[model samples]
Target chain A: MAKYYQPEFECMALEDMRALQSEKLVKQVKRVYENVKYYRDLMDAKGVTPDDIKSIDDIHKLPFLTKADLRDAYPYGLLGTDLKNCVRIQSTSGTTGRRVVAFYTQADVDMWEDCCARAVTAVGGTNEDVCQVAYGYGLFTGGPGLNGGSHKVGCLTLPMSSGNTERQIQFMRDLHATILCCTPSYAAYIGETLKEMGLTPDDIDLKAGIFGAEPWTEEMRRDIEKSLGIKAYDIYGLTETSGPGVSFECEEQTGMHINEDHFYAEIIDPETGEVLPEGSKGELVFTSLDKEGFPLLRYRTRDICVLSRKKCSCGRTLIKMSKPMGRSDDMLIIRGVNVFPSQIETVLIKEGYSPNYLIEVDRVKNNDTLDVSVELSPEQFSDTVKDLAIKEKALADAIKTMLGINPKVHLVAPKTITRSEGKAVRVIDKRKLHD
Target chain B: MSVKQISVFIENKKGELAAATRYLANHNINLRALSIADTQDFGILRIICDDPKATETVLREGGYISTVTDVLAAEIEDKPGSMAAILEVLAEAHVIVEYTYAFLAPDGHAYMIFRVDDNAVASAALAGAGIKTANQEDLF
Candidate 1:
C-alpha cells in the first residue's frame, strides 16, 4: 500500500477554462510570431496576420502543422529560438523517420515539469510516492518529462529507462516504487513478463502508472491494471506538445483535461483546416502558451478526435479532449506500434501471397491483439492448402516476431474479404480498448 | 539410374532468400545441388539432397508447399568440353535438358544433376554417351 500520487483537479466548469485559454493563447501568439520563423511562414501562407489572430476563433486563419511538417524540418528546422537559450532537448522515437525534437529553456523545462506535475496531481501522485520513470531514456522525451514532473510533485524520482525488465522489477520491489511511467505497450509487456516470471504485482509496491508516448486504449488500461494490480492512466502528449503533460485523464475517466493554462488546443477539419465545433471529431491542433524555445502555431496533430470545455469531476478548469480513434493516414496504432497497414500488405505480397487481407484487432483481458487474414488465389491455394494450416501458423508467428504482437493469420477464399476499390479499411478493431 | 530432386518456390523480394534459408535452418535440412528458375513473382527451387523426405517435411513445416520429383545424375570429368560433350550427346539423342546443377562426387568425379524433358529418354541417352549414371549413395 504505497502512497504518494494524488489527483488534485477533478471537477471544474467551462467558462473559466476558456478565459485561461484566451490569456495563454494571446501570449503564445505574440511569443511565437516574434520568435519562430516556421510559424511565421505558415501564418503567411494562410494570409493570417499576427494581429488578425485576436481570439481563439481567429486561430483558424493559421495553417495546421503535422508530423510531416515536423519531419520535413528534421532535427533543427522547427526550433524557434537559439539552441543556446535551450536548456534541455527531448524527442519522440524516430520509428517512422527522424525523431521530432522539442527544446526547452530553464523556464520552459520548469513549465513542462509543472504540466507533468499537473498530470501527477491529476492522477493523485504525491511527494510521499517513490516514482519510477521507466520510459526509455536518451533523446526520447518520456523519460525526462515524467522524471522532472515527479520531482515537482515532490516524489522520490527514479530515472529508469525501459527494457531492463528484470532490473526494473527488482528496483520496484527494493525501492518500494509506488508510481510508474512508460509507454502503454511496454507497460503491458512488463505486465506479461512479470506474470511469466511468476512475480505478482503485489510483490512490488506500484499502485499507479502514467502511460504515454504511444496510443493506447482503455482496454489496455484495464489489462495493465489487472496484470500489474495498479491503477493505470493515459497522459497525452507529443514531443512538439511538451511531452506527456499537454493533457491527462482525471479521476472521472471520461477524457484528459487539457491544461489550458500552458497550451491552447483546437479541433479542425483535417482536410479543409476549418475549425470544427468542440465535440466534433477532427484533427487535433495545438499552440503552446508560455513555451519559449519552440512554440508552434496551429500545429495539426493528425490525431482525429474531439474536444470539450465542460467542467470535470476532478475540479480542473480546462478543456478535455477525447482519445484519438485513429489518424488521417494509415497510422494503425496496434498495441502502440504505429505502422501503416499497407506496410504489412507489402510484406505479405513480397512473401508471394495475395494482397487481399483483413485485420481483426481485439482485446484478451486488458491487452490488445491483432489477427491478419490473407487469401491465396485458387491455384496457389491448392498447393498451399496442404500447408495452409502450417502457413497460417508460420505467417502469424512471423508477424508476431516483427510487430511485437502475435497477429493470427487466417486463410480464406479469394474475395471473401470485403474489398473496396476506394479507401481500404485494413483494420477492424473489435476491442473495447478505447473508453 | 535414379536421383532424388525436390522442388521449392521462392518469392522475389528483398531478404526473402534469407528468410527461406532461415526456414530451412529451423527444420535442420541441408541443401545439395540447387538450381533456381525465376519469374517475376516466384521462382522454383530445384534441389537434390540426401534426405528428400526430411527436406519436404521441413519445407511444409515452414509454410511452403514443396514436392519430391525423380531426376537424372551423370558423372562427368572436370575437363574441357565436359558440358558441351554431354549436351552434344543429349542433342543427338533428341533429349532436351531444361536445367542443370552439379556437385563433386566422392570418387573424385563431378556429378551433373539434370531435369530433362523426359527422364527415361535422357537417362538412356546419357548411358549411350558412355556417361555412368549416379545413385543416391554416390551423392556424398
Candidate 2:
C-alpha cells in the first residue's frame, strides 16, 4: 500500500501527537525567551513569558514573528543557541530586503536531515535508489538538505547542484538516477532539453522527482510528469523553516503532510490575526517545536492555504496543507484589483502556451496598465500578423475572463523568454518605481 | 507557384532594425523587396531576399527572430490597371490577402508578393487566371 519515512510519527494518534507538541512547545518557548534577546524583547513587549505557555493551546499568548522581525534580527539576532554550538547557516535569496540567515547545530542538522530523509522515503527512496540533487548549493539550503537526506536514506547521492542541463542529463543516464531533486521549473527545463537532444523519458532511469522552492500549478505537475515519465512530487519549505523538507507529498499527492512533531502549524486571518479552525483558508503560522539553534515561535508564513486532516490512503495521520494557492506577499494590486502571477500562469498553461512569460505592470497617467508577454508555441506561431494578432486577442480574452480585468497580451517568439535554474522571475511592477 | 519570403521580428528598440540589416549586409545577402508591419511594441519585417534560406539562417544566428514563409508572387505588367486586375482575380477566388509588397525587377517587370490566407489556393487561382507567377527559382 502506502509508504512513510517515519511510520511511527506519520501515523501517530491525534491525542499523542498533541501531547508531544505540547511538551516540545514548552521547551522551545523557554529556549527562545532566555537566549534570543530580539524575540525576548518581542515577548516582553507582548507581556509573555516562558511560564505563560503551559501547553500547545497556549501558543496564541506568544508574540508573533514576521519577516520584518527576521529582517531586524538579520545575521544572528535570532540564534537560540551559543555561537560555538551551531555548525552551519542557510540563507534566503533576499530579493526583497535583508536576507534571512538561519543557523543550525549538529543536532539541528540531524533533525533537519531526518525530516528530509522522511521526504525521500515517503517518495519510495531506499538504498537501491540514486538521488540526484540539482538545487543550488552554497548558502542555499535546497541542495545540502536533500543531499543529506539522500545520504541518510542510504541511496547513491549525486550532489550535482543546479545548471549545466546537458551534464545533468548525462550523469542522470550514465548513473541511472532514480530520484531527481530540484526546483520544478528546472526539472521542466531538463525535460525540454531531453527532447532537444532527440531523447525521451525512456532514455533515462528516473522514477520519481522531488521538486520545491517555488510555487507550481497542477497543470505544471502533469506537464513535468509527462515530459520526464516520472511521478513528480512537491516538497514545501522556506529557508526560515529548515529549507525543503518542512512538508512533503506522499504517493497519494493530494497535499503535503506537514511534520507537525517538529513544527506546529496554525492558520490565522491575515487581517485580524485570529486563529482559524481546520479547513479555513488563511495565512499559515508555524512554531519550531524542537529546534535549538534558530528557534522561532509563532512565525507568520505569508502563504494562503488550508489544513486538512482527512483520512489519506498514504497511511499518514500528519496534517496536510493544501498546495499554497498563492503567497499573500505575491498578490499584486493593479488598478484596484488583486492579481497573482500564478493566476496568469494557470491561464497560460490552460491555453497550451509555454509557461515562460513576462508580466509588466505600470501606472500611466493615473491609470494602471497590465501587459503580459507570453512565448508562442512553435505549433501556434503564424506567419501572418493578423493571424498572430488573433491568437493574442484570444489569450487576452481568456485571461480577462479569469481575472476580471483585461491584460494586454503580446505574443512573443518561441524560446525568447529567459529560463531560470532556481525561482523564476515572472513579474516586473514598474508602478512601484513610479510610486 | 509560391516564393519564399523571410520574416524577422524587430523589437521596437533604437538601432535594433539597423543591427539586423547590418548583420544581413555583412553576410553578403541582398534584399529584393521588403515591407514592415509595426505596432507600438514590436514590428514584423517581411523581406523577399535573393537567398531566402541563407538570409533566414544568418538573421537567426545574429539573434533575430526570423522565419521563412511561402507567399504567392505574381509578375505584373509594370502599368496602372495591371495591378488592379490581379487583385480582382484574388477577390473572385475568395482568397484574402493579409499583406502585399511590390518591387520592380531588374528585368523590367513589376513583381508583387501577396501573403494570402491560403497559399495553395491562391497559387491555384493565379494559375487558373493565366497569370505569370514566380516560383522559388524566379525569386533568386
Name the best candidate (by DockQ): 2
Best by TM-score: 1
lDDT of 1 at A116: 88
* lDDT at position A77, candidate 1: 72
Report, for every candidate in turn, its global Cα lDDT versus the true structure. Answer: 0.74, 0.84
Q: For candidate 2, what is the lDDT? A: 0.84
Q: Any runs in candidate 2 off by more than 4 Å, and if so which? A: A331-435, B1-140
lDDT, candidate 2, at B32: 80
User: Which prediction has the highest lDDT against the true structure?
Assistant: 2
**lDDT tens per residue, model 2, A1-435:** 225667889899999999999999988888888899999999899898899899999999988899888978877889999999999998764322446789999988998898899999998999999999998888788899999999998889999999899999999999999999998878888898899999999999999999987666677788889889999999988777887899999999999999999989999999899999999999999998998888888899888899999998988899999987755676665543446787788889989988999999875532467999987654675566777778888999988876657899987765667888888889987754211
lDDT of 1 at A392: 66
